[model samples]
Target: MTIESESDHILFLSRDLLDDIELQRLEADKLLLKCSRLARLSGTDEIKQWIKLEMEGYNGSKELSDHYMSRTGRWTNFAERKGYWGPLAQIEENIRVQKLRIDVSKVESLSGDGLIGAMRMNRDAQQALANGISSMVAIRSRVLNMLHTFVAGVYYERQFAKVAESTFEQYKKDVDALIAAHAGEVLEKLPSVVARLQEGNDEAVSQALTTCRRIIDSFADAIFPPQAGTYNLGGNDLSLDANKHQNRINVYVAERTDSKSRRTRIRQNLSNLYDRVSTGVHTDVTAEEAFSLFLNVYLFLGEILHLGVAQTKDSVMA
Candidate 1:
């Protein structure tokens, strides 16, 4: 798989991991390696350390759980079977089975070979399970990887609180700011939206979609209007496209904000809202979908407006 950026690679790896997991065709060792890479990218020491431990497995016999460290088997001597340690103790001891030292490599080979969850090897499945090696592999691939939540950044064991805190609210804020500046018409139409939704007509959906388009177009107009010129970005003089709102937003936001993640948000929200609502629907449109369109129109406006705000603030300061 050829991927470009760090974020793209992360996204690709995660998608690949999830695809295999959901399909239940998981490559246990391969999944571990991807998870390890993801954990490293997580930028948290705790997550990294945990993944490291999982990949390395138990250090030595001392660290291995007693359950796996030794195997218990009942030994029988037919001649002396009766009451050697008395019936009760003898039965207890016979049933109890003596614990003997076992090699970690014996059970561990299952995981090392990436065979888990019904995937058997030369050894009997039940016998291999006795060491709990498959369980450890599952924990690393399925359990630990799921727990990491590297994309979200805050979860059972990790840091990156700042990124976690800013998720939806930041998106909402961006949309709100955009609406305030460029959605005057949409706002006026909003008073009728509830009634329109109640009527359950496709017309309402069209109206909602059109309103979204208007606001975004207005937003684009406000920030980067149609101009027959080029924007000199660093040493490159990139010709401006009158039609490509994404390009405009990218250049503009990239100029103002140092945060690549924030720029990503602006581009994503803008593209989704603009592309989704831009095209008219031929099939039946539900009031729920129309309401969703309306909700998205409002929420997708603010961050773009934030760029404008920053520009205004800078101008005033100058």
Candidate 2:
């Protein structure tokens, strides 16, 4: 294209004066090599052809010059206003630094540790769900049996305390045995469960607990289940860390709730619920089911409470 601007004309003359025939051939070869590199970088054949044509000085007519001027004007406006680059060295440097900052920020947000943290969180969540569910099943069974025996002993005697006292001792022993056998299993799965709980919503946690309750109730009915008795298992008063004995339980619940000892309080309510369910039933609910039920209850309650708190805060802010 014929250079119109004084500055462009000077640039063109200077370059032409420097271009010997052998140097022109070498420059053409360099352009061809650049075309290949651009094609690989851009992943397009059209850009390669455009580079080839531009390097070969394939101007068809005066109309082509007008067309080139129009395209150049568009690009020049964009480079000057929108910060692209061409022959202007200072403008190119400014664009380079601004682009560098944006690229660095993106990389910083997704470092290696960040990726690993996300992966570990996911793995932990899956493991927790599985273990919590299993524990629920076992706990359900143990609670049911304790309740059945307690009721049987009381129903056949006048002294409720005497009957309850012996039953309570046996209940504690049974619980200890059950914990001995299954506590490690639950603890092993806690890291993941804690992670999963951290991500759960109230509805999801409630649904999971509800599923465990339904499964346990169904299983209990199939075993030493309901009979003609006054079994009160509908109250939600389980105390989680009231006795301060369940440190692991506290940690899991706290992490999930993002609150201090909220999980413990939830566990207490869950325990009460279990006791009520098993109070008069003649069923063989397993310890695993009970633990799972407890976990579910804690998670569900925490989710609901969290949402309520958030809503309250928003309302206050408004």
Candidate 3:
């Protein structure tokens, strides 16, 4: 048969390349086993003599003839004249052909087996890809959380700072007015009276007053607190009733939209890949195409997973 016809026949017989490999391997192994058994039964000396005769001819050297006679216990003249070499040579040639067939079969089998092994490898790659994707999603969530937490803390701190600054400014104005009003009576006691007046009665007001004093003492503190370094919106407290409720609604809507889009894309890609693989396996595509598809899916999954992991790390840092 033509090479193309043979290949087509093989594809028709087995959809999977692995199945073809396994069958050829099995056939080769059987033939090799048969040959080994035949060799054992025939005896090594007999086999050697057979090989020697096949190498030489019936009218070969006396030395070779004598050696063959001694090993097989058959006189050279009787063996040669009766055409013993002819039958034995044919048997040896058959065995050699069998061995060659076995070897060739095994090579072919292994080629197909390797492809199947590659397919299995792709599965591991796919899993890794999935894991990577999941990890990235997790990382993104974490980054977002940290950012939220930072924002919340900053917001609260800024609000407190504003209140404190306002209170301090008012206190400064009041002290100036009191000093101006009592200027004639207590010129020397102005500082002490201003200090007393600045100290508010209520606990919250007192705290605000203290904070204002600290800000005034250190101008840097008023602009930026030492503890609040960077603003991150992730990992912010989600327990605030109004903020929590609003965020929940937003997250739900976002998740639904993302889920729908992801599903549609994945389904479409899978369908396209499936068609390519199927066509390649049977007719239009070559062995190379089949191999490529397997590799493509494997690589695609891995890339997705890698992206996910990166996103995850970014989220964590955030």
Candidate 4:
């Protein structure tokens, strides 16, 4: 319902936006195909009313320019000051005037490639249709890319939450620091998503990515959070039961028995899980691969918890 992250908002909105743009492009293609069909039926041997028909459709097609122009209306201020208005108006007027000039027969009079060109559609009408479609496509690609980045970041955080919150804070202070750094990276990426919505322009996407990368690069303090720790001998620390403190099947298993070898294996398992997920975070992995990794991390955190409990029991026995 309420999407908190701006990037997430864009990512979610993009699904519908792409559908609408693609639908418009399909409509434009159909309109052009109709023009081509009329051209063929009339024959290039003599000028027909195809051009007049196309101009009429261009004016009548409510789907063509309205959405794109409305979205990019703010940019029109720059487009107009740079003298784009004259060319834009000229294209509109040419299409408009052709509707009344049915008897002019200018397109049919032309021979060779000129005639071939008219057969496709009126040149201006073809261009207008193409521009509208291309602009929509460009926006779609950028939005899709933004969504990809946001999804990947979410994967990292979810995976991290499974691992980082598995151990007590006082026992593994460095691990908590690592989780804090990761939280900072995730937060840094969220604020710029508002700017992304203002204009889905190239510059906006680039700026958002750059900001996120800068924060990611700053996380040099710790790479991996520890999974196992002893009791909080120093009672000054806060005891917020995180993912680390809870959901540990290993800890439950360890409390039942005194076997030391199985506990060592649990410690090794936790270490292997951390290494695997750390690599996953720093590299490219498909969605399937990422999800598999998240499950693996979840299971391994439980093993880490078990190892921590076993070690604490052994220390008490000694």
Q: Give the winner by lDDT.
A: 1
Which runs in model 3 stand beyond 4 Å of their true positions?
1-117, 136-140, 178-190, 193-318
Instruction: Please say which candidate is ahead in TM-score: 2 or 4.
Output: 4
Q: Estimate the TM-score of every prediction.
A: 0.38, 0.17, 0.21, 0.22
- Output the number of the TM-score-best candidate: 1
lDDT of 3 by residue, 116-135 (tens): 87756655665555554443
What lDDT does the true structure give each of the candidates? 0.54, 0.40, 0.39, 0.41
For candidate 4, the lDDT comes to 0.41
User: Over the stretch 76-102, how does candidate 1's per-residue lDDT look in tens digits?
Assistant: 232443112111122223222321222
Error of 3 at 133 (Å): 4.4
Candidates ranked, most accurate by TM-score first: 1, 4, 3, 2
Tell me the tens digit of each residue's lDDT in model 2 across 142-232. Answer: 3223323332332334234446767868755554344334333332333443443344654334443444444333322322223342322
> Which 10-residue window in model 2 sums to the lowest lDDT?
82-91
Q: Between candidates 2 and 3, which one is better according to lDDT?
A: 2
The count of backbone overlaps in candidate 3 is 16
The CA lDDT at 317 in model 2 is 100
Per-residue lDDT of 224-244 in model 4, one digit per residue for the tens?
A: 222444433124232323333
Pairs with steric clashes in candidate 4 = 165-244, 166-244, 250-306, 251-306
